[model samples]
Target: MRANVDFEDLHFERRPYDPQVAYAQAKTANSLFSVEATRRWQDHGIVTNTVNPGGVATGLQRNFTTAQKESLDAAEAAGVFTYKSIEQGAATTLVAAVAPEFAHTGGHYLDDGREAYPVPDDASLADHPHGVKRWALERAGALRLWEVSTALLTA
Candidate 1:
């Protein structure tokens, strides 16, 4: 985000403080980080997974103004984003955490209770597609990001 760069080339070390792109980078990093955890913890019978729980209208948006809330409502109405209740939004993670089907399905991203496809969607509140980006599953990038995050945290 600090650096205007290609989507595939997001660098964990170079990630800046730009709220917009930085948020996306952080989301990508979380998915890749989950992949790393799945790799290192699988033999221990540990499972690590990630989920994009879609959009949920809840107290989380308590700060949004009327206009902003309306914007989200409009988007959901237009099928640009899927709005769910707090309980409904937690469904995917709840399944990933306890569902037997995911016991061996580590290192994957889920959308609506299934493996997410790679569908790049418009981000202008125009269209919201539920899919993980290809970069989110990059093992090498995950490892690198793990190192960077560890070093930063430790320092």
Candidate 2:
């Protein structure tokens, strides 16, 4: 029942499948990967960052469960996010890729074309709509995720 970026139950082998929990875990993993990758490879000119393009009405959402769609609708209604066009969503990625400000910068999460504000790990989406949670940037968690992922790949 302990969701949210757990290494031991990473694949949900020990818990029921909850779409929201799975999505959250995946996002956390992405953030951790960026942090660890930057820490381990920045010296070699490699930069890694996580980007949240806000919500885009894309075909990918076709697979969304009813609960997922409802959650997104609620978030939108609460002003946590507004759906963006594909172009709008891609803009942030372009900024991360080519913006001089982000050049050589890594281990940061970008939202809406700039670095997202940092929020406490327990911060609610309603409180920090576009913020990056502290848990996502924790170095120890990032390192552990890196090691676990590497082991998975090698195994």
> Which candidate leads in lDDT?
2
Q: Model 2, range 1-155, lDDT digits (tens) per residue?
A: 12259787887899776766787788889989999999999999999899888778877577678978998899789877689999999999999999987789799999888898888767776677678888888999999998998899999
**lDDT (CA) for every model shown?**
0.70, 0.84
TM-score for model 1?
Answer: 0.72
Candidate with top TM-score is: 2
Over 1-155, each residue of candidate 1 has an lDDT whose tens digit, in order, gives 12122344455455433334555566677788898998889898887888878777656576666776787789778867777777888898988888888888698888777777654433322333555666678788788878877877899
- Which whole-number lDDT from 0 to 100 does residue 95 have in model 1? 81
Instruction: State candidate 2's TM-score.
Output: 0.88
Candidate 1, which segments miss by more than 4 Å at Cα?
1-22, 59-71, 119-128
> What C-alpha RMSD separates each model from the true structure?
4.8, 2.2
What TM-score goes with each of the models? Answer: 0.72, 0.88
